[model samples]
Target: MGAVAKKELKQYFHSPVAYVCIGVLMALFGFFYTQVLISGSSSNISYVYSNMFVWCMLVIPILTMRTLSEERRNKTDQALLTAPVSTMGIAGGKFVGAFSIYGLAMTMSLIPAVVLSFVGKPNWGMIFGEYLGALFFGMAMTAIGIFVSSLTENPVIAAIGSLGIAIFLMVIDSVSSAVNNPVLSKVVSWISFSTRYQQFTSGTFDISSVVFFLSVTVAMLFLTSRRLESRRWN
Candidate 1:
């Protein structure tokens, strides 16, 4: 698993894609950071976090689009499958690699938060909760992208499919409101990413929200491993 993770990380660094993605993420973060801190004179960092969540909808798909898809495209997936490593290890390794980059990007984005701390007495607890939520959110989104990458050999298709799923999750609250059945609507809202994330942004460390994000990450990784295993048999 470590080997696979190292390879994935190395691949990312060796390619231009990683740099481009990081550049875009930093640019977006800078925009929000400046607008919220400098222009608005607000000590609240939640706005920056909320905007990052939306940006993740696009960044994550680009990051994970080629994880498994590129392997299949290059006819290297067979070698990976036949290796001694378990399917779950490969999936987990890929997820960790992609998530490592996501975490790095998030850390870079937090520089503005650190700067803000010097200017005003922001709630440190709330900031911590927001960062935790962002980490969990990135993990779940990366897992979803990995699963989508497993479904297609074409990276473009994987990216588009992952983006579609991310958008769906982001807008799930609106979709739930259109449902007439109260029970069904409640159920739908329960699974919405925003519903869970709102707790953290509001300075609440809800255990249920943490579990929900972890469950999504684990379930998606499990599904990805199963998909690879099925291909091994075929």
Candidate 2:
């Protein structure tokens, strides 16, 4: 798993994907942070984090688009599958590699908050919770992208598919409202990413939200592994 992850990371950096994704994320973060500072709206860094929700939907897909898709396209997936590693290991390693790139961008985004501290004190606990929420959100999105990548050898298609899924999750609550069945609507609402993310911006560590994000991440990764496992038999 570690070897796979290391290889994925190396691939990410060796190409322009890692640099482009990280640059875009940090640039967006800087833009939002600057707006917050100028507006004097809220001292809490959660403001920037909250505003970044939609931007992440764009960035994460690009980050994970090539994880598995590129391997299949280059006919390297067969070699990896026949290796001594389990499908789960490959999926997990891919997830880690993609998420690590995202994590680095998120970490660098903290520099703005650090600079803000010189001017005024921000709520550190709230910032922490927001960061945690963003990380979990990124994890789930990365897993979804990986699963999408597994379905197609084309990275462009994988990216579009992942972005579509992210957009769907964002508007799922609105879609649910159009449905008449109470139980079904309630069930659909349970997977609303924006709702779960909003809970963390309030500075309260909600266990349920954490669980929801992790469950999504795990389920997507499991599905990705299963997809690979099926390919192995074929």
What are the per-residue Cα lDDT tens digits for candidate 2 across 1-234? 999999999999999999998998899999888887887754646779888988987889999989999899999999999999999999999999999999999899889888877777788788888989999999999999999999999999999999999999888988888889999787876788988898999878889989988999999999999999999999
Scored by TM-score, the top model is: 1
- Tens digit of per-residue lDDT, candidate 1, span 68-107: 9999999999999999999999999999999999899888
Off by over 4 Å in 1: none
TM-scores vs. true structure, each candidate: 0.96, 0.95
- Candidate 1 lDDT: 0.89
Model 1, position 97, has a per-residue lDDT of 93
Question: lDDT per prediction?
Answer: 0.89, 0.90
Model 2, runs deviating above 4 Å: 41-44, 178-181
Clashing pairs in 2: none
